[model samples]
Target: MSTAAANEADAGGHELRDLVTGLGRAFGGALVFSLPMLMTMEMWELGFAMERWRLLLLLASSLPMLMFLSHYSGFEATWGWKDDLRDVAIAYGIALLSSTILLFVLGVIGPGMRAPELVGKIVIHAIPAALGALLGRSQFGQSDEEEEEEREQSYGSELGIMAAGSLYLGLNVAPTEEMILIAFRMTDWQSLALIALSLLLMHGFVFASEFKGSEATPDTPWWSAFLRFTTVGYAIALAISCYVLWTFGRFDGLSFSTALGVLVVLGFPAAIGAAAARLIL
Candidate 1:
């Protein structure tokens, strides 16, 4: 072969190898982030008992978010809309396959089960796994190139990252009865206090600390970061909490106040997750 032909062949080989490596990391991330929910009894029960339409809506909503995540921090660096879409598909595929294999191995799924039950279980669990897959490059080990890309993201993209992070953490715990139970036990005063605490913690994580990915510089005004990132991030967290609760039917029979309380309770962790996303991703 000519010199140019040899170079072209080497480039093709490297691209193929990178694709395989990226897929492997995506699979590892899917399992690592989703293992807890996969083992939860509540998640298993919610799979079959929740409304099919709600499950479908959840799955549908996850796609756009996954695509955005791929653009921001997929298992490999994406170059264009097509690359983002491809990564989204690959991540979702990895999520579904991994969830199916793990559930089957644990006897959580089997041939005896009906199709809806089996499919619902895998689909619900796959949401977070897919997010993890898309986030694998950033969370596991981001390259310098990817880091520069992330830093140049617009303010809107920053909010999108916050929402994704909130959803990931909220989904992990929303299927559990504890969210409702804690909400039930808390008084109005306690809920107010918890909301305040969540904001404080969220602000501390991103702006107040000297962490590696802290969004604020020493010269940056505290109040500016607080209003722009912290407050908005908390709001995103609360919204995601409400959506996750609604999806899981947690708000089905509650009174208005009780439902609000549940949102507050879940928002605490969601807020922290949102703040942490800025640091990590």
Candidate 2:
């Protein structure tokens, strides 16, 4: 081959290799991040027992979130809406395949199961698995340039990231019975204290810590950051927590007080997740 043709062939080979490596990372991330949920009994039961409409809604809602996440940080560097959409599709596909294989290997899925049960189980788990696949680039493959770009994101994009983080962590624990049991055991005063703690932790994680991803600066006031990012993030966390709970039918017949307690309980972790999102993602 001529020199120019040889160079062109090398470039093509490099591109193909990078694509394969990214796909492998995405698959690894999907399995690693979702393994806990895959093994959880509640998650397994929720797959088949949850309402069909709720399941569909969960699946539909994940698409936009995945698209937005892909825009910010995907399995590959995306330049436009088309790229983001393609990444979302790839991540979802990886999630579905990974979930099915793991569930089958674990004996959670089998030959005798009905279609809805089998599909439901896989679909429900795929939401978080897809999120993990998209996050693979951010967590395991982020370049310095990408990190800098993320740091320069707008306030709205920052909030979007927080919401994504909140949903990711909330989904992990939302399907469990322990959330309700903890809420039921706590007193009203304890619930209030938990809310205060969540807010404080959320604020501290982003603003007070000297972590590498901390957005705070000497010139920026603590209260300013608290009000702008921390409080808003906590609110987003609560909203996401409520939505996850509702999606799982956890609030179907509960009273106002009980539901509020459960919301607060879940919000604790979600709030922390939201705060840490800026640092981690």
Candidate 3:
């Protein structure tokens, strides 16, 4: 074959392989995010008991979130809005199909179920599953070639990535009663210690430690970097925790100190997630 023809064939093969790999990643990510919720009795109950308008609102909001995720860190290396849209479609499609298959196997949905009932269950589950699909690549996709490009990122961009990571990780565990339980068990001193530990770990992961893929601006002093990233990232994490708590209606009748404690507990994971985002993405 001519050189150009060979190059074209190789390119086509790469594209096909990428598509296949993306599909697999999407499914894997969907399962990771969905399986826990699928197994939870509360999730199943919520599916049935949730108001129709609320369900519709969740569905509507999920699309934009999916798009934003795809644009930032998709299963596919998307270049533009068109590619983002395509990935969002693919992610949602995979989430819907995978949720249906798993839920059916689990007997959450079956041949005997009414259409609306079945759709509601699947849709409720698909929101998180689809988010997983979008995040799968960022969390699990490995590529040394992609990692080598050390692009200089702005503060705003870094903050955005950190916020995304915070939200993703925090959202996973925030809806459960355990978050509140864990909070209620902790005293004021413990909460302060936890906050200190979270900041220390976040700094270690992103700025101070020698972990693989850790970021360092050689010109910037370590203490300054530590101060900035630790403070900003923790703030973002706290904000995400509050939003999640509010979203799940976990804030009802809570005292100020208790709510603050809950936010700190959840913020631990969120801060680590933010640090991971800086290192990885």
Candidate 4:
């Protein structure tokens, strides 16, 4: 075959593969994501968490990332690492925004609801996303399960609904003071945790679905991938913390509480990614 024809054939092969992966991801999420809900309702006996319920409503609400990521990962794997990283950034970014939006909507719709408390629950719950990101990242450079894990290791902003809540709480009453005080509130452990858990769950589920693929790859061993993901994420987080401290850290305006609060809020996704890497990857 001519060189030109050979290249074309290789390129064609890649496109076909990505199409398969994308379909696999979308269809997989569609099939499985809702499984958790039924188990959740049965487990907790709670109603669906959404604007309204319809058959598969919550799953319908959720699972785009599943389709997106499966296709995303499959495409990336078939295509290149750069694409995979881009997918991760986009997926996580959307996740962060969505969770923040939901918190506000819930706060507004449920008058009796304690908004701050709701935020906290979200962070804790999102532990999964952290798992997934790391899980996904770990796959980037890894070895297959054939090698035993010789080692072990571990480890967004803003919706006005939050602003309105702050006002209701007290900050909103005034405007300038409210903004600053509300910034502090954003750092709260509760708010921080909720964001963390919420992001974690979304990503975690996606990563877990892909876990099998990573392990099957000769380079990607399960435990090592998890440990590596945690280390890398923590390293990045630390560097960011330092930058924040150097820039905003000194001012009394930015206290430990604020820092911790921000970390928890932002770190929530990291936690989820790391966990997913560790557990699922």
Candidate 2 scores a C-alpha RMSD against the true structure in Å of 1.8
Best by TM-score: 2
lDDT of candidate 1 over 1-281, digit per residue (tens): 99999999999998898778788889888988899999999999999999999999999998899988888778988778899998898898999999999999999999889999999899989988999888888767865665676646677887898898899899989888999999999998999999999989988886544534444566778888889888999999999999999999999999999999999999998998898887777
Best by lDDT: 2
* Inter-residue clash pairs, candidate 3: none
Give a tens-digit lDDT track for model 2, residues 201-271: 88778754453443556567878888888889999999999999999999989999999999999999999
How much lDDT does candidate 1 score? 0.87
Per-residue lDDT of 104 in model 4? 45
**How does residue 7 of candidate 4 score in lDDT?**
100
Q: Report every candidate's CA lDDT.
A: 0.87, 0.88, 0.78, 0.35
TM-score of model 1 (CA atoms): 0.94
**C-alpha RMSD by candidate, in order:** 1.9, 1.8, 3.3, 15.8
TM-score, every prediction: 0.94, 0.95, 0.81, 0.26
Mark the 10 consecutive residues where model 3 has the least summed lDDT.
Answer: 207-216
Query: What number of backbone clashes does candidate 4 have, counting pairs of residues 3 or more apart or in separate chains?
Result: 34
Candidate 3, residue 41: Cα displacement in angstroms equals 3.1
Better of 2 and 3 by lDDT: 2
